[model samples]
Target: MITGYVIARKPMYDFSDVIIGRNSLLRIEDKYYHGIDRLNWIDVESRFKQSAIPENLLNVYTDLEASEQDLTGIKVLKKYDEAVVLMSLDEEMTLKNEILVIASNKLNQIKGHGIATVQTITWLGYDIVLLGGWSLIRHAIFENRQMSLLKVIALNSFGLLDNEEQADDFLKQYNKLADLDSVDPLLDNSSYGVDCIRVGVL
Candidate 1:
């Protein structure tokens, strides 16, 4: 099974919306019963971009949030509660070669953040296609693509590395890539841990 994690800017909606009813119409009933509003991709993405603490974090923050909607039918095993550190897996395991990452807003907006600093690194072209952030996931899932990778990491967790020394050490171990030139910065790298997905061909 292809495995990866998503660090979302917001908590995932409970999976109930996708499973509670026998038919699509019934599902709509269930949604109304459960008070789950249908969330459009654009709505969700905008929410994250606006809620993100530092304005600059918008790039990565929106990227991860948008990816979640890409799957045809996705289930959320865990969700953010007043902000959380969580992981997600596709129940059908349909994704063949995709990697995804999901992170919370807290983690996305730190000043002098190495992850952000290295944003340029994501552009390096690699064997794998890097669709910029979450939008790619949405495209893949909507288009019914067979294999994709998503990388979602919570920015809040990285807050621990606020110290420059610690941040640098973390980058040395996690961000170093032999094929930095191969990754496409605009493509999504959330599937393989951000550090592992190279800029070159996958």
Candidate 2:
């Protein structure tokens, strides 16, 4: 199990009760700070630098109304609307994960060749990704759902921390060498209750 502080987070979606479904991505666009009608669904591919087209057509929508299509077959992975946190598992579990952090924009991004995506979707609107094998808590996010909250901020916005010293500091403290097979993340349950847990918007 992982034991860490959820130091920061951006807000979750304002998925309101609807009067219409004609367009639903407007709130999403707003969440990522997009201008009205300035967004293009086709632009998503380039923004995420994705070579393969997404399986779900609704993934790149630019509307203000939502439908069942928005879920893309992914069941919501966490309950109590548990806002995904920036989890840095304990050193005991770190040998497996090695504190690797990556940046991602795809909700369905795969954990390939010993890689795992970070639980947090956005940090001040930039995608937070991880690179390592999955622990039980981290794995649950993937096993229960096939989709991730798509990284919605603009491509240029990704530069927010790319050139800063803080980014380097974040990378240095988080990364570790590979040795993932030994740890059993299933045995840990520190995230559900408050030992070192704190959940809310940043």
Candidate 3:
């Protein structure tokens, strides 16, 4: 099974057809690739089934002490935290520009302190929504010593078309997705990412 920590997941349609020639996105270790490029959906599903979800990370961090260096550094920035998980649990559908930005914006809208960021991690396996934002937010509350069950770190998943005819029709109707006036999802998600891993250290 592939192993890695999740950071953030985004919705909306990109050039999956043109770029990777498949619908599912997968990240193995630190590299992102189309799931079909390496393995079929069945294998992907089985792997995820065997792989640990973000919620399971709590067991690893519980009772562990974090040092200052663990909170900041190049290694910390690019490194994956087994506890800091991100997931996309929807079919790859074309999104209206505004629609995709909503989930990524949640962190910036609320994280009043610290460096927050966002990254895309695709959940190509099953229908499980495991701990969506709770995994990260729980860490946040644990850091502040005001622990509760409110999961604030947001994640998003969008629907995608499996049929070539549907995708072609979508492209025709949309006509220039890039030029279509829409908020950039990445621009707003930077800080969200920072806050996500921040809790892992705490």
- In order, the Cα lDDT scores of the candidates are 0.25, 0.23, 0.23
Q: Which ten residues in a row have the lowest lDDT in candidate 1?
A: 29-38
**What TM-score, over all chains together, does every model reach?**
0.19, 0.17, 0.18
Q: Candidate 1, TM-score vs. the true structure?
A: 0.19
Q: 189, model 1: CA deviation in Å?
A: 23
Each candidate structure's count of clashing pairs: 64, 14, 17
Ranking by TM-score: 1, 3, 2
- The prediction achieving the highest lDDT against the true structure is 1
Model 2 C-alpha RMSD to native: 20.0
Q: Lowest summed-lDDT stretch of 10 residues in model 3?
A: 93-102
lDDT pick, better of 1 and 2: 1
Residue 129's lDDT in candidate 1: 16
- The runs of at least 3 residues in candidate 2 whose Cα sits more than 4 Å from the true structure, single-residue gaps closed, are 1-10, 13-163, 177-202
Model 3, span 80-195: residue lDDT tens? 34322322222221121111111112232332222333544333321110111212111111112221212211112211112222323322222232134221112222322322
